[model samples]
Target: MAQHHKKIYPDVEIAMPTRPRASLGLENGDPSPIRWCHQASPSLSLIPSPSQTPIQTLNLNPRRCCCKCLCWTVGLLTLLLFIVGATAGIIYLVFQPKPLNFDMTLSARFNVRITTDNPNKKIGIYYEKGSRLSVWYKDTNLCQGTIPKFYQGRQNKTVLNVALTGRNRYGTTLLNALQEQQQTGRVPLDLNKNVPVSVKLGALKLRKVRILGTCMLIADSLTTNSLISIKASSCHFGLKL
Candidate 1:
């Protein structure tokens, strides 16, 4: 018989008993309350969190959002401009101020005097610089000058005086015509004047517009240093933008 020797096991390597093999029904381990709960719990980790959701999955489109905002802003600005333009149009229509009416008081050799009246009841006229005053006989422009800028009140009249010199080329012809007209006792004259003006209606003031006046007259003579008589006179008035 072989003699059996007792082995001392202290500090010697000992193999651990093998764990029982998991049942076929259990994937990782034996079933337990904790384990079943952990397996059955909704897959919160697999489901994306709000912060971790894919950018493409969001309902918003960045390009479309920007386009919508831009369209709204442009539409609003267009509406505002339309309203402003309509309001200005209405104001212009309601305030149709009359132009200035002018008449010649004195027309002597190298001297002219004019008087003007504002016809509108509520409209005031403010004349700016760059005015022109001229006299004509038939097709000849005899003299040219400038009128002083001034403001005319409603239904008010203003007088102006100017010294005129004839054009060098036409001085002799103009003098001959004047002498002939004096002998015939009937002289035809044309006067034209233009000035830039601002119109005031009530408390509202408008931008500058041009005031033009043309007068056709039948005069008795071209007397020097004496007031000439006007037999008949007709004037036409207009405004230019």
Candidate 2:
């Protein structure tokens, strides 16, 4: 029996499973010396680091990023405004909008002919409502009218006919004075206008703008029975800005 126990034994050594050792410096830490930018925190917290000196940190998440978002939005808006202003200035310089030209006649009422020359090749004008026109003589408004709504094309000339008719308290006095001036061959009158309009640039339509104008004219007569002719006229018209 002792001879049989010592006869045949196969397995002798056993190995217990163990975690493999880290190799090739993969698990130790980041080896490169370059450090990533650290975000600054508003919390009263302390974190240990190798370098004690306060490094310049980005305030990326300050105050939960609310103030940062607001500042970025404001900066973007300001930049957009500056770009728009520059583009507008360039457009103005290259294609200057010319002032309108006016011609007039009187037949108991004022008949005005206006000519507009738009310079922008891509812009169009749309005359809106709330338009007004007036004629004055010696601090008295003699007549008033309106500019009929219409659309004007780009880089084109447009003509308009406006009739101004009204009555004043000093009609008789004004008639006498007009007759006296007609006798002197110069009947002075001042013409004014305020017209609201919209502009179309490319695919965008702008807000209403006031087109203002003033005309100084010398006429031969103001009576319906007599022939009324404009002698000398000076007119100026522009956008009210």
Candidate 3:
């Protein structure tokens, strides 16, 4: 019996227990790519690739964004224009600049004279070149002259003198009328003026405009050497744009 126990068998291989494959839904015992896919739970979500995303979600929506920006820009410009218009209207209403007031009279010697003493404290006048003065009796033109360009200050008086040196073809008739009027103590004369003048408000000078004036005067006599009295005088004023 001692001899039998001492005897040993040749080296033998042993087998180990394997994990269950049914949990992974694998028909074969070896691991595979399909086996890994089946190993995940059905509730797990799949991540989408960059190219597979929806076009609507990925796009920047340029049309809507540009429309919003354009609308805002237009609104701002409209508001600015409106504000400017309102401001200009207010300024025009507040500062209404007007032409100078003129008073004219005819002398006994058929001379035309004009005087301006600015009645307004805030407005001034600048007389430009090409100003004209004329004297008329009915349809007859008696004298014509030009006024020297000058600036007239506010509340300051300016005087212009013009002589009737021109003689018309009907001078004898005019002379007779003048003599008759002088003896009758009443002379009817018309004074007309065309003046280019710029208006001023405080220190700002406006665009140049044309002033037209007409005056009807009655004097006592036409004597050049004697003192004369103007009995009645009326004037009308207009401006050309």
Candidate 4:
């Protein structure tokens, strides 16, 4: 028989194996430890913030505007006044009245007569000192006595004979003669029937006189007597010796 070796086997555990545990606390069992973490603070610039933009200001000049307005107003007023003045002047000229020019005749002529009554009376004829008688007219003296020369007829009344002539521009002679006659007092004579007689008197005065041509007597039928007064008071005649 061979000698047989006896094998020995190790003993095996009969229970399950347990896992190892990690400790999260200190050995003295204090509160759990705080975890430390590093993080960068947010970066910020120190430059000053942009300054607020300066507010824009609008500029206004009241004095300049007022001056311009005043100048324009004064100019307008002056123009209006000028227009009004011009209009008024034109109106005055248009409405004004026109002046009149008068023309008159300078020369003219008329016929006249004269008479007297005293036979032995010396007659003295006078006229305007500056006026001249007509070329055909003349004056004669009959006697040196105050009365004219004449013969008493069978009627026993003195009859003085005288001849009168009138010829010239009536305007000059009549006005001057009448003015002079008014200054003297005497009676004018009348032309005889044998002599051709032409009588010329103021036409205007005749209507006033209304006297009978052949006689010195007034006609009662006439309307005006103004000429009678004018003739009697404003006219005279005499004989030149």
Against the reference, the lDDT scores of all candidates come to 0.80, 0.82, 0.80, 0.37
lDDT of 1 by residue, 23-70 (tens): 334656656534322356665547879998878866899999999999
User: How does model 3 score by TM-score?
Assistant: 0.50
Candidate 1 C-alpha error for residue 212, in Å? 1.7
Model 3 lDDT per residue over 33-128, tens place: 543344665786878998997677667799999999999999999999999999989988999877896544333244556677888789999999
Clash number by candidate, in order: 0, 0, 0, 22
Q: For candidate 1, which ten residues in a row score worst on lDDT? A: 101-110
| RMSD values, in order shown | 26.1, 34.1, 26.1, 24.5
Q: Which stretches of candidate 3 lie over 4 Å from their true place?
A: 1-111
Candidate 2 runs further than 4 Å off? 1-108, 225-227
TM-score of each: 0.49, 0.52, 0.50, 0.18
Q: What is candidate 2's lDDT per residue for 1-241, written digit by digit as tens? A: 8887886778877776576634334466857555456789778877768598578877666686888789999999999999999999999999997889654333247777878889899999999989999988868788889988888888989888888887665556667778888888888989888999999998899988998889898888776755568889898989976
Best by lDDT: 2
How many Å off is the CA of 78 in candidate 1? Answer: 99
Question: How accurate locally is residue 126 in candidate 1, as Cα lDDT from 0 to 100?
Answer: 90
